[model samples]
Target: MSTRREARVTAARAIRSHAEDVVRAALVALPPRERTRRGLAFHAYQRQVRTIMRADPVAFEVVETRMLAEGHRTSVIEVTLRGEVGVDAGDMLHVLWRNDLDRIAAADAVTAARFWTTPIPHRPSRWARVGASGLLESVVDLSASTDSDPARAERITPRFFTVAGVEASDVRLQVTHTAGMPPRAASFLARVRPGDVVEARVLPHPHRVAHDGPGLAVVTGSGAAGVFAALRAGASGIRLVWGLGDKQLAPWVQEELREHLRAGRLSSLRLALRPERVTDLLVDEPIEQMAWIYVSGHESMGAAVDAALRARLGESVLREMSDGLRCIVST
Candidate 1:
């Protein structure tokens, strides 16, 4: 191995050792009940680190530590890896710290804490419906408002994750928001390595329209991932409509959409600033001839779209519905 490769391997070993120590110390300080609850997750994280170290050989170093509200501190870690490893550092960090941040802080005698990793590219996986069986890569929080109820907002704000180990020609990312891309969405996009070819469309709220054909897909709400799945399955055209309710349109939103239009990925895009019903944004298009129709965002929207499609197409359309997004494809 070259000198740099040797250094990375050595650093990776050191990180593994330190992580083991930290986890051990944290476990010892926890009460038995808490320990039992956290031990499994902690060990699973450790194993993930070990897996990366053994196969990919990456080095991890803390770049910055920031103090947050309520005495919490977040540490930003930069990951360095050579070649393809099929590991998403950001998603790994999410699995490591999202739910366990508070527990880690309590055991370590620090404040509530979080962890984040800078963007790094690995490999792509098989594209399927958002909730379909695949290696879950990242869960992007798409909530637009602070007052939005988590339970209710989760239905509309889609979680975007990628499967691993598939050779794909391209990766398409669709982001819908009232103003511009959310911070979380930007972060998720940032993680795409500089070398990856990603076609990203940032659009305003969509008002539904009629479908074209098997080569076409219409996505309402936040089901961009459904379009991605369609693209992977060789769908040639995509229509994205954002349902922003009564939110005010920011000038930046249109500028960004114009930029995407210049770059060209969406077959058509629309923005609806004010709509009579938010659920109507789900599937306003006539779906008799559509090859794939995806409605994601709200449960009520999913039901309405499903009912409408069923009423029109009867049982001929194969349907897959999840809590967050719904997929309807012709057999």
Candidate 2:
């Protein structure tokens, strides 16, 4: 077997739901209006297999016209997942097999079905709507790192936990979701059946602590200011502004972020990479049904961050910002 497969097998065993952790964390930072009890009841679905980058890459994408489309609030990465070693037994290289889904679901998804969903992506989200299942996909992607070092997995777990903390904060059960969702909603999200240790204690976002969050919008230029404008007006919700992938963000800033991440102080992080494609490298398929999350990202480094956020999160829930990202103001 190649080293990539070796890495995949190694990563699949440990970090099975890396993307889910990110999605769930992103929800935590949404606007307070949307964080209500019922709002969160349905919104928690974002936490499951949704964020995992798909094995097969696609070219089609949705557009995000919201004002808060800054890259800071969202997570952008150049993840190089190894061959589908961890996915299934088939010798052929494609990894997104159904057997792998059944197995991981058995371990994580089945237990935590609340978080996991069929492969179909949700349509763009509306401000007032958080719908349920769209389709049933046998194929499942386990969010894991290709790194072989145990310490790397260990180090990354903290990132997952920190983001999970962001998910847990201020989330209330909205009557809309409660009335519309099935009876088992709370039971599932409170502690999904899957026995995954998805949560950790990371530092709080500076805005979460200082401003009594939802955190502050650290807007940079006109784009950022636009995002700040929408957010201040209550049209937008949780989001961030990202830095350049190569040189935009200084090295010192990256080091400080690492330290803060360890301390759980840095609520979010960003990297402005000039991606060849629109969707994030972490996710293989085009974004969908994740409209509940509101974020903004860079255009040059990658596809429009707001576009991805808007595609996942429908326009209704999105608030346009002066900056280039969309804001998640409500559930």
lDDT tens per residue, model 2, 1-331: 0112112113343244445454546654565345444444334433322333222222111111112121343311111122212221101111221112232333322221222222212211111211211111221222342222222321111111111111112111101012223212121122222222112111111111121233423221122322322322233222244333322443543564465545444344443355423234324322332222333222332235545555654666544321212232210
**lDDT (0 to 1) per candidate:** 0.32, 0.27
Clashes of each: 8, 65
TM-score of 1: 0.36
- Per lDDT, the best of the predicted structures is 1
Off by over 4 Å in 1: 1-222, 225-235, 247-256, 259-264, 272-275, 278-284, 318-331
Question: How does model 2 score by TM-score?
Answer: 0.23
User: Which 10-residue span in candidate 1 carries the lowest summed lDDT?
Assistant: 1-10
